[model samples]
Target: MPIPDEAAASAAHSVRHLFSRRSLHVPGTRLGAIALPAPIGRRHHWHYWWQAHFLDCLLDEHLRDPAGNALSEARKLARGIWLRNGGRWLNSYYDDMAWLALTLQRLDAMEGRRRPRRRVRVLGDALRSAHTDELGGGIFWNTTRDYKNTATTAPAALFFARAGDFGRAQELLDWLRTRVHDPATGLYLDGVKADGSAGGVVDRRVYTYNQGTVLGALVAVGGRENLEHAADLVDAVSRSTADDDGALPLGSSGDGGLFAGILGRYLALAVSTPGIGARAAATGRSLLATTAERLWTGRMQAGPGVFLFPPRQEGPVSLSSQLQAWTMLEAEQACR
Candidate 1:
């Protein structure tokens, strides 16, 4: 079934009411709160990466309907993030910075301005700096740099590709291909430890978001080999990660909640990007449409005019989980 734009917009509005809040209580603070519900204590937490995804979703809403106020909301959230991060954008996690940089890049692109270029450059440079010879040449996960992982490197590659640094992007993707790709499952592994405790040991854990970001990076840095790999990865995800009903695995609350939606986001990208193969495109579209339909059908009313999605239908509603559902709906809408 086709997912309508209204459904996606409703998902966006629901999330905004339930989770989005001003970064601070002070006057003129742009909306930027990502918190739990009242039942869950409504505590405000600072998750740099989650805020990045929230901003991206706002942009998605704006793009879906240009006449709406979502752009204004996105601008506020951007400012809120900047102010909340102590008037800076750099963070300890390379992956977090990369995600924010990507959304900022999109904002810049949509507005036809380079206003966020400086921040994007700062993030791109930080990602570049994180790439070292350690652990077979990939970006480190955090500032401590004890491990190199796809969580950081894949998105970093995507950020670089979007920033017109194809060379660096290709370098990062090559590192993943050599060090992190698991031939057995046709999916990428998590990361390899570079610390003394587990030096050079591969994590071997396959995550939905990692596959999504890698698919995005592959499509962004398009070539015969990369496109072929992208097609194979899509098929692998459809075969391995999805249930018979086409619903991808819903991760736990907190950061894990965004996993399936992240995969959905890039799967939508694969569906739209040219030369990803017709089979892969169909696979991506079917997965997104089916999963989004399921989520929409299963949504529960939290209160009057407040609808939220549980983590997996039985789990508690968190900012990440609700955002994940919204993201999947948006993905399906975009593909449609």
Candidate 2:
């Protein structure tokens, strides 16, 4: 399962190219923004959530080349995010903030930098503030408070668990279990309306990142029960998410492009988790290896490590898509 050195070199070149073209140094702010590359047609611009994934990619690149500037670039991006929000990491979207907190926590663990403690605390408190008893207790997607989604709640739980706030993490876990989880499918549903009067209609669509963040949270706060739940989730996604050729489908370029890579990362973690059954671990590794091979050999075209999201051909390159592929490649190597 060692990634070909050519693949690793290609990934490094793609990541560095992305930083050069997409990253912005906001004058007078510590934030180095990774803005969306220019459009060929209709496209999203400057999504705040993407920077967190970018930092995660930088972490992978740093692991590949410790002597490289990945750490310095990550620090600048972290500070830029903080400074851009007017000295606060909190934003209208709690989910967006939670992603940053999670990334900062990992960056801090890896680099032991000075600012993450304060940043994580501030962002963590903000995430907790969004949770309410409205829909039987889960976090809303944004400050508007209209929806309680796994996208927000699961990552919030992960941040708390990773930051050692297990009590808060369990609160999120409890809410997810009783509310949005579809026991029949062994997967969490998409979301529910936050309005109590709406009777909490849960959207049943299964997104890979939602499943992933939940799995990651459970892994952080480990126990036999949590591991069992993680295994069930892996079973469900492994059976359901692949396309005809057995390549995992990341639905589209925007958020969908990152979904499977997110799952791949946690799946790798599942493989390494002690006491998880050997069968589950083997399954996880197989999924990672297979998906990485497909993406590396099939979807990548033109530029170094540039991946076209499945069926789409014409548009600016999706930085998220490329980052996710790099994550898959990195996870494949690390887990092996």
Candidate 3:
């Protein structure tokens, strides 16, 4: 069964009400708490990439309801990110910068505004510069430039494709195919070390978000070949990740919490995109619907108009977990 529109909206509303906080001194800036019922008197670590995903979720809400305050709220959150990141949009992590760049591009396109274009351009340039011949050609994960992985490269490919730099995007994808694509599992490995004692060694760990970004990048840079690859990836994810009832396993807290939801977001894209095989699309849709139903069923009420979502059917509540559930619910709604 498809998730109801009201349920998705309620999840969004609860997330905003429970996690959002405004900076008293900064006036216009706002940031999300790292956890719910935020721990008092402790210094909250600012998670750059997590905030980027949060911004993307806000844009998802805006697209769903044009008349709502989501766009304005997104603007404030973007501003907050800038302020928190020392007034610069470019971050050290190529993946972090790519995520922000993608969200900024979406914000500009949706609002018909040019304000984020400069930031997007800077981020794009940084990502391009990070892509070198190291590890047989892929973007480095961060400034240390010691590792190249699907987590960084795939999103960077999608960003370039979205920005009309298809040559660069395809180059990145080609490198991924050569270096990280696992033939047996049809899933991507984690990354490769650049200069350690274990240099040139493949991590070989499969991650849900890595598959999600690569799946998204392939669809974004669509042709007959890329579409076929995307379909195969969809099939691979369903085979390897889904349970008997098609629900994905629970991701861990912190960054892991967002993993399955990220995959669900791209799975929705595969379901909606043209030219993907029907079986692959059906597989994507079934996983999303099943997981969303599980999330809705497992939600715990926190207060009037606020609810907490675990990363899976059961776990401790954190901002990342709640955001993950919201991301999946929104993806399910989009598929509907």
- Top TM-score hit: 3
Best by lDDT: 3
> Which ten-residue region of model 3 has the weakest summed lDDT?
309-318
Q: Evaluate all candidate structures by whole-model CA lDDT and list the values in order.
A: 0.85, 0.74, 0.86
Which residue runs does candidate 3 get wrong by more than 4 Å?
Answer: 114-116, 196-199, 312-316
Order candidates by lDDT, high to low. Answer: 3, 1, 2
Ranking by TM-score: 3, 1, 2
The collision pairs in model 1 are none
- lDDT, candidate 2, equals 0.74
Single out the weakest 10-residue window by summed lDDT for candidate 1. 33-42
The candidate with the higher lDDT, 1 or 2, is 1
lDDT of 3 by residue, 6-112 (tens): 77788889989998887434777778877766756436676888888889999999888889999999999989998888888887789899889888888988988
Using Cα atoms with residue i matched to residue i, what is each candidate's TM-score against the true structure? Answer: 0.93, 0.88, 0.95
For model 1, state the Cα shift of residue 270 in Å: 0.8
Encode model 2's per-residue lDDT on 9-105: one tens digit a residue: 4664665564443223455323212323554332434566877877777777787789988777777777766655566677899989888888888
- Count the clashes in each prediction: 0, 2, 0
